[model samples]
Target: MDAYDLHSGNGNNLSGYANAQIDGIISALAVSADPAERARLLAEAAPVLWDEMPTLPLYRQQRTLLMSTKMYAVSRNPTRWGAGWNMDRWALAR
Candidate 1:
């Protein structure tokens, strides 16, 4: 398991142990049916999880743009999965 851990860690050099910890947490959450239990585990593990310094936040993206005037409407539903789905609906600018 240590070898796997080392390889996985190296493969995800940007996130360090974050990926592993998230995987573990997800797996634990999946197996746990109770919301309270899942919340408890997340609360207990969150601080310790960051102790490994698996990931670092370099900068934050304050704003983003699509850059289109032709399109009559372009909006994303946060509940939806992917962002790029309606490129065909965009119209050319006159």
Candidate 2:
């Protein structure tokens, strides 16, 4: 599929073109009931854009937060938000 990212305005995350090419295979994998068939189609579609991605992985940064004895509801992997983004569940130890 040919991916395009117009919103980023810098052209980073678009895969529409590549997506178009393998859309059938993706759709088949989605609706396929048989596990073997699903695996087969997934295997068939995974390599369509091998070594062709615009962006490459570099490194993973570890996030660490030291909270006091009262903090809670912290997410393990807060990709879209901060570690303590969900503060509704926070409580203090009496």
Candidate 3:
């Protein structure tokens, strides 16, 4: 809902093309049944976002994951909790 509000074309005239594409994507996603069609729509919008660059990065963060050779199940997420977040699902390699 937040995203829907963020790029809504209800009354605010933020920008033309970006607003239309963004709101279109968000609204369409609510009822989009075909995953492949969704992918195509997402792909269609990516370049427009790239051209606009809504978020300009200023810095970076670094993280490391350490695992033993025998431990085979680990997930690494740079943006969220790291490799141990889902330790409940981890298993040995055998």
Candidates, ranked, TM-score? 3, 2, 1
List lDDT for all candidates, in order. 0.55, 0.55, 0.65
What is residue 20's positional error in candidate 3, in angstroms? 5.0
Weakest 10 consecutive residues of candidate 1 by summed lDDT: 1-10
Error of 3 at 63 (Å): 4.5
Who wins the lDDT comparison? 3
Instruction: List candidate 2 segments past 4 Å from native.
Output: 1-18, 21-46
Off by over 4 Å in 1: 1-23, 59-94
lDDT of 1 by residue, 1-94 (tens): 1212322434634335445555666567658989899898678667765676544557654434465676665666342334455656756668
* Global local distance difference test of model 3: 0.65
Expressed as tens digits, the lDDT of each residue in 59-86 for candidate 3 is 6556688888888667686344456777
lDDT of 2 by residue, 39-66 (tens): 8876775576464443444765667877
